[model samples]
Target: MSARITLASGVTLNTQIDGPDGAPWLILSNSLGADQSMWDEQIAFLSASYKVLRYDTRGHGQSDVPNGPYTFDDLVGDVIGLMDALSIETAHFMGLSMGGMTGLGLALRHPDRITKVVCADGRADAPAPFVGMWDQRMAAVKEGGLEAIADGTLGSWLTEDWRAANPARTKSVRDMVTATNVDGYVACCKALQKLDYLKSLGDVKIPVLFVGGSEDVGASPETMGAMAAATPGGRYVEIANAAHVANINAPEAFNDAIKGFLGV
Candidate 1:
């Protein structure tokens, strides 16, 4: 069922809850430019056997996308608040890119609330050159909104071979990106620029699984490896031929890795 959780920020974020009620919960958080829909493939694979919760972040998907600049705490609070509203005391949390950063925030800020963490195609710290890219993206989104950046954004997300091999699915994903709100897009870009969680990760005692796609353009294997190395018991895994959206690009492998991690 679809639901809404009113956060301490006074903002109401939309979410969806499905799967077996008594089963362990697996929450999927999407990348910055995408929504919870990115995990549609994973949901199809995991929902029948396990309880699955997927939601749009503050400004992405069907959720509210407010004005400028949101903090990691803001994103983390959304997940925590959603769990509270759903009566979920603790959950196995997972995210990609921006969503992964939010997962890290929860692991650090509310350690007791996460059973384990799976960060796919994400980094603990933003790479040096990415700061410039984020600035350019924020400016472009602010000026022209999501449409102006949709094509290039999609271009960077999927490998050229995947786009060539799966034009239909690629087009569908691109359409979703174009449909996002410009204000929300820009706000997330600004948030991406200010992201830094090197210290926070040091305190993440929960088991963490870092999955990086060999073809990932967003966060490289080297970077994600560094992120995993930072966590106490974090381990890194690579999905062959998968890009930024590993769950979409490599659903079977993504599903297996996550299922094994959560043991559900």
Candidate 2:
């Protein structure tokens, strides 16, 4: 069953917990436009050895969509709050894209709370050159709503062959993108435009795993691997024939990489 927890910050998040209570905890955080279901494929595999926790980020899933211009601290705070409510002291964290960025922040701010970190398809900083692009995206979403960005996002999220062969799956992903709350999307876009957590990673003293899709146009393997190398105990893996949503595009490979890393 799904649980709704009202955070200390006055934000309510929709969360789901599975697996045995005595097992080690593992939290799966989704990308910008996805909800807890984004990690559906990995649940059975992961839950076998872990108390798996999945949640919808504030603006993306069934969670509250607060008005715009949120900060990294706010997002991180939400996770901390959820952990507190669940009485979890620490857990292995795996996040994709925006969620991965949140993991980075959580590691830096609450290092004691994260045992291992997996940052998949996430970036540490946003270049100034991309500011204009982000502004344009925000403008488009505001003007045309989520429909404005669905096609472009899907194009970057999956490979051409995958889209062609998996039309139904592709449509499902498209639905996720277009269903995103416009206010949340715009707010997240604004946050991404100013995000910069690279320099702070040096203090992150936890084992880190960086997963990237070979074909991901947004966050490539080279970039994510470099991020891994920069961290003290960082490792890297690449899933071939995958794109931004590598976990979904290449579930077996993605799960293998994670299972091997976690010794599951």
Candidate 3:
């Protein structure tokens, strides 16, 4: 089932719910330019054992795109508000890229609200280079819109071989990128530029599983492994031969790792 839920925060989010009526809740968050549909591949598989809830972030998909310069606090508050409105006290969360950073922030800020977190291809901190990269991206988007960065984003997301073999899927993802709201994309990028939660991982009391693609230069295995090492009892999983969007590039392997960690 799908609906547009208006949270107490005054933001309406596009959300979809699947699986049994009464089961453990698992929320899946998408990367920067994608929407809830990004998790289409894992919905059925995850729904078999858990009630899955996937939603578009504030600035993406069918969700409300408010004013720019959003912060991690705003992003995390969206999730908390959504859960509160739905009467969900706690739920498992899995996010990729921008979504992953939001997960880390959520766990750190509200450790009691998440049972476990699967942070895939996400960075905990935004260093100088990271901030500089996003600055360039934001400038490009402002100058030429999302079209200017769609190809580069796709290249970073999936490898050449994967894109060549999965033309249809690749096009679909590209369409998603091109269809995203430029203002929203830039706003989220601003939020990403201010990320600095790496050192705060130790404060996260919940279980966290850092998943990264072997070939993801943006969020390499070493980065995610370090994140896991920093967290008390956190674990890291590397999806071989995949890039940033590892779940889409290697769904089976990604599902196996997440399911194993979630014990579903």
Candidate 4:
């Protein structure tokens, strides 16, 4: 069920779709710099029972990055367009980091398309401290190229101990990051600069499951707890020994939690 889709915007999304039909559809979005393959572990287990859709965001993996300053609407449109192309009406949505922001955008603008939303290791509001990093990252990626951020993204994506213990997997993720195009990465960074969803968070009405990594420095559980408190029927869970990509860091526990949350 894996294929390449040409979106209306001319970006070719390299996607992998798995599992049964009419079952709960789980759409997996990636963190920054990586692509659809990052969700390999979750797709393996969930696809047997639930339809799992995973793809690269603009500027990453096999997806095409055409231009700059892409808005949240553009990202959401890509998701909707993919669903239209695939004939999907409603599906369970889940994302991490930038992907979480995408999910938030979809919930705010197109609530009817989502069955439930699960945002892991992401923020509803653009934290101020990250702005500085965003600026530096843009400059580095624009100047030194994608390789400049590969090692750093690798370390931040997972804990030091985890990376040391799983060198092969770590290397694979790092390679994905390093292979990214500089202009594409910088363009997404610009999109990040304009992203803020505090006003829109209150508009999302679907059941929301907030998952966080115990060691996530970017979007801490404390912040996710605050987000959960803001939204009714929001349940927050923290994955132990994980950082940003908890699904990759702690696959079994993460999958089990998602299965239970989605009731799959």
Among the numbered candidates, top lDDT falls to 3
Pull out the clashing pairs in model 1. Answer: none
Could you give candidate 4's per-residue lDDT for residues 156-228 as a string of tens digits? 7788998999999998988888888776787787777778886566667888888988988888889888887
Better of 1 and 3 by TM-score: 3
User: Residues 1-264, candidate 1, lDDT per residue (tens digit)?
Assistant: 877777666677777777977988888898988887788787766777668888888887778877768778678888888888778888888899888888888788787888888888887666568888888887888788788888887766777787888899898899889878777777777778778897667788788889978888678888888888889988899988887888877788878777777775
Q: Per-residue CA lDDT of candidate 3, range 44-71, in tens?
A: 8999989999999999999999998999
TM-score of each: 0.94, 0.97, 0.99, 0.95
Give the residue spans of candidate 1 off by over 4 A.
none
Off by over 4 Å in 3: none
Q: Candidate 4: TM-score?
A: 0.95
Indicate the residue-level lDDT of 45 in model 3: 93
Best-to-worst lDDT order:
3, 2, 4, 1
TM-score of 3: 0.99
What lDDT is reached at residue 50 by model 3? Answer: 92
TM-score, ranked from best to worst: 3, 2, 4, 1
- Which residue runs does candidate 2 get wrong by more than 4 Å? none
Per-residue CA lDDT of model 2 for 1-264, tens digit only, reads: 578888888889999998987999998898987888888889999989999999998888789988879888888888999999889999999999999999998888888998888888888888776678888888888899989989998888888898999899889888988888888887888777778888877788888888989998668787788788778888889999999999988899999888877778
